[model samples]
Target: MRLPIITFGMALAFCAVHLFVGRLRWLDRTPRSRWLSFAGGVAVGYVFLHILPELGAHASTFEDATGLDAPLAEGLVYTLSLVGLALFYGLERALALSRGERMAREGRDRPHHPVFWLHIAASALLVALIAYLLNHREDPSAAGLALYFAAMVLHFVTADFGTRADHPEIYDARGRWVLAAATLGGWALGLLVELPELAIGCLFAFVGGGIVLLVLKEELPEDRKSFFLPFLGGALLYAALVLGETYLAAA
Candidate 1:
């Protein structure tokens, strides 16, 4: 009962967080690596501790409903997740290269880039759709939803860092609005569209993989200067929060 509203609020909260990061002065003064590391850790932790377990459960349902062997259904979903992960990784790499080439060729400060807009447009849709999925669950609780909210807010923040690095002017002026609207749009879609059990399972599996790719791509760096303590601590804290939720459910 309360969970769905909270989930919707969290979705809106994500948009608000993005807005603040884009316009506010606080994060500008902080060491971004520490914040980014924490975000990446929380995002990864949510995928492993919460999303994967739920995916496993949904896989069984998928098998039962689809007349496929349980193992086969699980394999298919996992494959989808891997494909999603690889697809996004490839997109990010390609976009990076393309942006570099354009910058080198132009030899001037470019205020706008197509790749940044394309990437954020796609990312915004994904984020919103994921939020919609979260709320559409048959039985949602406030605690579980709160964990997702905490994780995704950080996740989006990490993403914003990349957006700002690539195109600060464009992102500040328009990119944030697109993402915020997408969050609300996703909630609307969830209310209007209902997916079959198998379909829902597969969609989430896909998202699970994408989450892994996005986080690792940022957290792992060639220079090896990525902060580890905040990352590790955030993961531990989120994991504890998840475990506490499970315990509360059981008790």
Candidate 2:
């Protein structure tokens, strides 16, 4: 599908960004939190990849279908995808800054941090609801759910590049190198295992990589509360645009 191309590109972008640049140290969270984040991602994959498309197929409404469309379906999908993107971005940024603050404090929790767990949980549920639609009845070639799962997992793993280190709160150049290695390694592995899915897998990594770049340059201290709103806003903007494009194309 045409949307797969965009999805593929975005997924690749996520990986490439991390492969070359490395993750910012400030963004990593607790190991438990990270696992939870990954779980949340899996849930998201389950929904978007497995369930959402089914709902979209029966939507009979522009808003409902956009979320389902692989490339462009309805306005709501546009909104949720972008919002989800923004929330993910915001969490990444928050983790980075929190790490920096922790380092400055010499390993103390930051007061008044954003509610990341809630965000992750919410994201997981949303994805789960969507994934449920992809019952075990869908065709093989139309296997978009698997692709979605790949994208989400890769994104989650790539995001680790930013936080991986002796201490996520502390900055280190070596972390970037490691991230770069992971990115390339991931691609290589993708090639060896499933050459066909390789393209889409790499695309997922690319999007993660882009996110690393966007927040990598900003010092941890500078990316505080103010960054949250803008990040969400950007996601919303992308969703709106996606919706508009979908409508125009469908018309």
Candidate 3:
């Protein structure tokens, strides 16, 4: 009973971040906020420390469900991870090219309506998967759930900033709503339907890959002028927390 209540609260929190992210004007800046960079670092740390390791641990379960050869079954999750990363990378590149072309033609740097919708659809799907996973976590401990929630909330801040930057007017008007709805809808679906372990593993792997690409894209772009020290601090802090949690669980 308490777990459902807590999960529902987390779901609402996820939706709130998307719906209200535009109001955070401080995050809009030329040189990117150190805090956003720090958020990205924590997100990356969670992917590396938690998500990826869990995917590996689920490899055998995936193998049993799929009944593929050992090698293929073991590799499939990582392959899906790469596919997710590449898919988002391709989307980002497409948006960049479209924005450049639009800038050259109309003196506007944003994607057209079609491209914007396409991007939003993809983003919403990712958000939905994230929300769904919140209800289907491998480790449902209070500490684990809290860590996951904190990392994702911070990640969503960075993600919302990027989306809002890309299409400010449209995102505020419609994109946020779409994502917020997706978050809640995903949670509702999770409450009603439980997927197989293999399916959950696949979802986690794909999301992990997407997160890595999204976080790195923001940090690695020189034009953003991202802060390094804050990023490092965030990564180290999150890594310590995760390690401590693991140690305690083991004990």
Candidate 4:
């Protein structure tokens, strides 16, 4: 039980990277694009290799338990994913539209967009959900905890860069703190209660879908500028590592 408390420290440290890493001169000089691509690769790889399989099994079980036909359950899962994608991308579109309106009305640029804050709020919820899942997992071994921390911390850093880049000041000032609080909030919830298997499966689908849309939309900018080698390298490498670990654990 006491070991779980370290998760709070881990959450703080994870959030701290968002808060302070921008201030480092060396990081400033580094080519951020490739790093972000690799980190995104790592995250996307983890989802496909690890989380998706679990989500699939859970989804199947959920359908069985609920007495829903396979097709219906599958369709609903797909729709949930599409809904998640639409929400985030739709928010981006709304932001663009709002920007156009502001420019026409004011005859100049607006420094900030409201949609960015919405994204921040949405992302905070995601962070919390993820933290809750991590803390409430069936096994809480040292090795498992470490690996989960390593993977998720990178995922958070990469996913967060997109948000911070969009509105550095806003994300840095208030968004970071909000996310930190959300992490602790999730942890507290995990300590207090557990979600039913059905709810877990649904949350997994929602978040997985959101992550797929979020990472791709953020990584793929206009002009198609990206590092494919690093991207593939990160994905393949992480996939191999995760698979190897899973096999060893099973054996």
Candidate 5:
């Protein structure tokens, strides 16, 4: 299904990006730092592409059932609809964060390199390609996927900016919780109104919940939150859920 294709492509892309980052020689400089940076890229990719989408879909279904009029695109609505309503205004606050934005704002606070921006542009292109592939068929379920993409984009932006500004060296468990809540809470709200797919929603929610717990592993003193952990966990969860769904469909 779409999940497998998305997962494989993401994994491939993750590896490629890491390889590129490894060549930086300045940012990574050390072997351990290089590995960590690569790991972070992989984790970010998996979360944005996989786990977030599933959560968004579930939320969309829930909203449709409960008749909350959360703005379903195709009997599939998104928790993002709620966020988009806020995002429009939230940007007005002007956090003076976001490295990309900061670069533009400072007019001269530019980093002594182009590798980061190059990587970003490359990532945007990759995401565009992935979106093109995934954006076919405006069915209810597909609509859910679309919403997931939007929500994940926002989550990624927030997490990227937050972690980068507040704790460049350490991971932010607080931000992770917020991300989880935003994603899960959105789905839960959607589900409240959309019960037709309750069973399916429950299945998705179970997987989503697993993702949250797995992410919490980062909070553990011993676990130390590798970038790979979130990605690997999300990929495994998605792969397992997709397989299970396929088996059931076949049966």
Candidate 6:
């Protein structure tokens, strides 16, 4: 009962981030906000320091549940992570091409209407999956949940900014509401359905890969003029927190 309530609270919080991100005018800048870069760095830290390691730890559990050959099972989660990264990379490339074509043909710089919806739908799915995982985390402790929530809140902030930039005309009008609803829907789904540990591991792996790709994509673009110092500060701060949590747990 307590866990569900906590998870629900987290889900609402996640939804709020999407719904209210537009109010963060500081993030609306020609050169990307240093804070957004910092958010990206925190997300990257979470993925590399926590999510990937958890996937590795769960590999054996995945094998035990599925009874696959040890070698195959061991490599499978990592492979799925790669697949997740590739999937998002491909999506970004497609969006970029659409934007370029539309700009050249119509003198507008956004994806086709259909492509814009597709991008929003995909983004909604990603947010939903993250919300679902809030209930089924590897570390369900208060500290663990706090770490996950902080990283994700920041990640969503960065994501919302990027998405809005891509489809400025439609994003504020419709896309944010879609993402917010997806977050709550995911939490409700989590309450109703308990997936197997193996399935959970796979989902986590895929999301981890996607996070890595998404964060890097936003930060690495030359035109964005991302701030390196804030990014580094964010990464280091998150890494230290994660390490401290690990040490306390082990002790």
lDDT of 2: 0.38
Q: List model 2 lDDT by residue over 208-249, tens digit each.
A: 233333233222234321243333443344345434544655
Q: Which candidate achieves the best TM-score against the true structure?
A: 3
After superposition, which runs of candidate 1 have C-alpha atoms over 4 Å from their true positions?
Answer: 1-4, 24-31, 108-112
Which should have the higher TM-score, number 2 or number 6?
Answer: 6
- Tens digits of lDDT, candidate 3, 151-190: 9999899988898888889998899999999999888878
Candidate lDDT (C-alpha), each: 0.75, 0.38, 0.86, 0.70, 0.38, 0.87
**Stretch of 10 with least lDDT, candidate 5:** 87-96
Q: In model 6, where do residues sit more than 4 Å from their true spots?
A: none
- What's model 2's lDDT at 127? 30
lDDT (10s digit) by residue, model 1, range 35-107: 6777788888987887778777878877898888989988887888888788778768767787767778886
lDDT of 5 at 66: 70
- What is the Cα-based lDDT of residue 153 in candidate 3? 95
- State the displacement of the C-alpha of residue 205, model 6, in Å, after optimal TM-score superposition: 1.9
State which candidate, 3 or 5, has the greater TM-score: 3
Residue 210 Cα positional deviation in candidate 6, in Å, after optimal superposition: 1.3
Q: What TM-score should be assigned to candidate 6?
A: 0.95
Error of 1 at 173 (Å): 2.2
Candidate 5 per-residue lDDT over residues 1-251, each given as its tens digit: 24535534433333333223223344322222333334334334445555567556666667766765545532332333334323322332222234456568775432322333332332233233333323221233533453345333433433233223323322233323333333333333333433246445543444343333322322222433344454355445545544554465568
CA deviation > 4 Å runs, candidate 4: 24-32, 99-113, 138-145
- Per-candidate total of colliding backbone pairs: 0, 37, 0, 0, 11, 0
- Summed over model 3, clashes come to 0
